[model samples]
Target: MTEVAEICSELLRIDTTNDGGGDGPGERRAAEYVAGLLDEVGIEPHVFESAPGRTSVVARVPGDDPDGLLVHGHLDVVPADPAEWRVHPFSGEIADGCVHGRGAVDMKGTLSMTLAWARENARRGARPRRDLVLAFLADEEATGAYGAGHAIERHRDLFEGCSEAISESGGFTWHEGDVRIYPVAVGERGTAWMRLTARGVAGHGSKPAVDNPVAELARAVARLADHRWPVRLTPEVARLIDELSRALGAPIDVDRLEEEIRRVPRAAALFRGVLRNSANPTMLNAGYKVNVIPGSAEAHVDGRFLPGQRDEFLETVDRLLGPKVTREFVSFEEAVSSPAEGLFDDLTAALLAEDPGGRPVPYVMTGGTDAKWFARIGIRGYGFAPLFLPPGLDYFGMFHGVDERVPVEGLEFGVRVLDRLLSSESSTM
Candidate 1:
């Protein structure tokens, strides 16, 4: 296999699924694999565990004191079903110029690039102007409680004075039919996970049951999925609109911006299904036997918030899911609060230099990430996992979808951009 293919395969073989399901919880073997590789390259890793098996490791390529840049990616990923997937999720198959498996896209692909970079930089003894911190984290697929959350809570000093960090998104090569644009995620929406339960009368399935809990759960699920999140206009969205206007060479109505946003290559992905506040009924529990109608049913919903809109998001959630639902932070990552001033300047220059035809626009990921944890310590989190995807390929759908994979060439392209970024961003500081 080629280099990028190799990276994807190796990571795929690691089986780092998150706590929501599958092979995760304890990142021991996966973390050890990364830590061992870094060790081979002579970087001592600082490994921390939140629980037996759960782990987050940090290896610093030491640089100037006080302010360092952290490059992070999570190890855990959402579970995959072999029955639904074309390839075994953990088989780490490299085929047809792509690496196929779970975490291949949602991250592991990006993580592999970071690992490759560590080797490239370490081999050259290249010294960053600021300390370069590499975090091979776990539990991001869950709440990050055992991964980044634990690291921040327990190993705050390791990230001491970190000003900014980069992670597994954005800055990748995107193939528009005519243009290649790298959408850098400067921010992400906050997450609010809620648990809902409906309790009613239990009865024999043979008998016509009324007020059945299962029926209530089905209603609640419909309510959550049908409820729309209020359209929020954020600084990131405004920037995106500006870019699209220039690209289309016409005034794309801001009111119908959602449709216009979809016109831009993969970013049309940003306008995915239900392009608003969303609540998903991910899990459901009911009666065990067919002979009985369960009296109690439960479900979990994932909701998101725009930056500085957490309180408002909470209010919306309360109104939509109903007060009976138990609201909680399934995965809480604060939306980037501060403006990305110099950070974007450097990133934009890098993208422009790499793909002059490509547009580097600001984006706000609708999901949560470890970036939220880093943002807490005064570190600005930018999703800059560079990739150049070919047209017609739905990149977002590959998050954990069947035959999840990354382009062989795209990985190489990402490494080139990352190399320039690490070189350019570090020197400028």
Candidate 2:
């Protein structure tokens, strides 16, 4: 097995499961393991704890250029059930030429590639073209309050000269016939985690109440779920579509985008959730007893908006929900968009250098990441955790899915691509 695969397996074995509540085993152990790995390469790493066991690690590799490049990956994984998987979720078993585990694809495998790249550079006594800031963050699966948020709030000086960052959710191989397409993320949709409440009269089971909060809330939830958001294309997605048109030699109608996406099966997964805003009711709460009518009802929604469309999204949502239900934000963050012209050129060059036929395109991520936190400090973040996968692997479906895994060969391929990216000189910095 390659060292990168081994490292990923070991990381998967350490259960850094963040249940979003303060329940799961924290990331302290994983932070320490990463710190030890950096120490082996004669690099000093600083480990910080936001709370008792919520931990993060940061280390810098000084380089010839003054410009800094931040490479970050989270240590947390969403909770997984062992009984639901082909192999135990936390077993980190190497089976069928893949590393099988909960975090093998969500993030741990990508982190392993970065760790391997740093260690390999140390072995050769080489430094990157620009200053490299490596951060292993915590609480990413949750609010990121204890991870990137904490680091920026308390220790912003640690990332002094850094302007650009590369993290998860992009730069993986997507095969279409003989074509290898790499979608590097240039932006992400904004988050609007909301809580809705409906107020009415509390009554006995037999009483015929005029105002039932439970019914009101259920109707609002249904309306929100049934509303079909229209396509609001941002620059990042437009660029992706344009490139896909040229690469696949398929004509795409901007007016009939949904139909066009359906025609190109390979681009459907990448374009599905990102073309417009979306909201789904995830949780609901009402009366304690089935027979009792509740005074108030509450529901939670996972809402996402395309870049530059937050206000419009909220207005439409309010219209759909009606005034019977009131809404308040549980968590709200702006969409992050990076320039597609400069540093992206460097990323594309690096990918093509390793795989000449690989076509690199820019896309907006449907979900948020720790990148949102970094964007607060004026840092541009790109989702680029390079991986080369075989055609049959359902790469996108593996995130927080059953039987999550990463191919062994993909990890090694990522390490080489990372090395090339770090070696290349770019004017963006």
Q: Which stretches of candidate 1 lie over 4 Å from their true place?
A: 1-5, 19-26, 64-66, 83-87, 198-222, 258-267, 271-275, 286-297, 321-333, 424-429
Per-candidate RMSD, Å: 3.6, 2.4
lDDT of 1: 0.74
Maximum-TM-score candidate: 2
Among all windows of 10 consecutive residues in model 2, the one with the lowest summed lDDT is: 420-429
The stretch of ten residues in a row with the least summed lDDT in candidate 1 is 420-429
- Candidate 2, 263-346: lDDT as tens digits: 887876777778899999999999988788999999999999999999999999999889889999999999999988788888
lDDT agreement with native, every candidate = 0.74, 0.90
Q: Give candidate 2's error at residue 214 in angstroms.
A: 1.0
TM of each candidate vs. truth: 0.85, 0.97
RMSD, candidate 1, Å: 3.6
Question: Model 2 segments beyond 4 Å from truth?
Answer: 24-26, 424-429
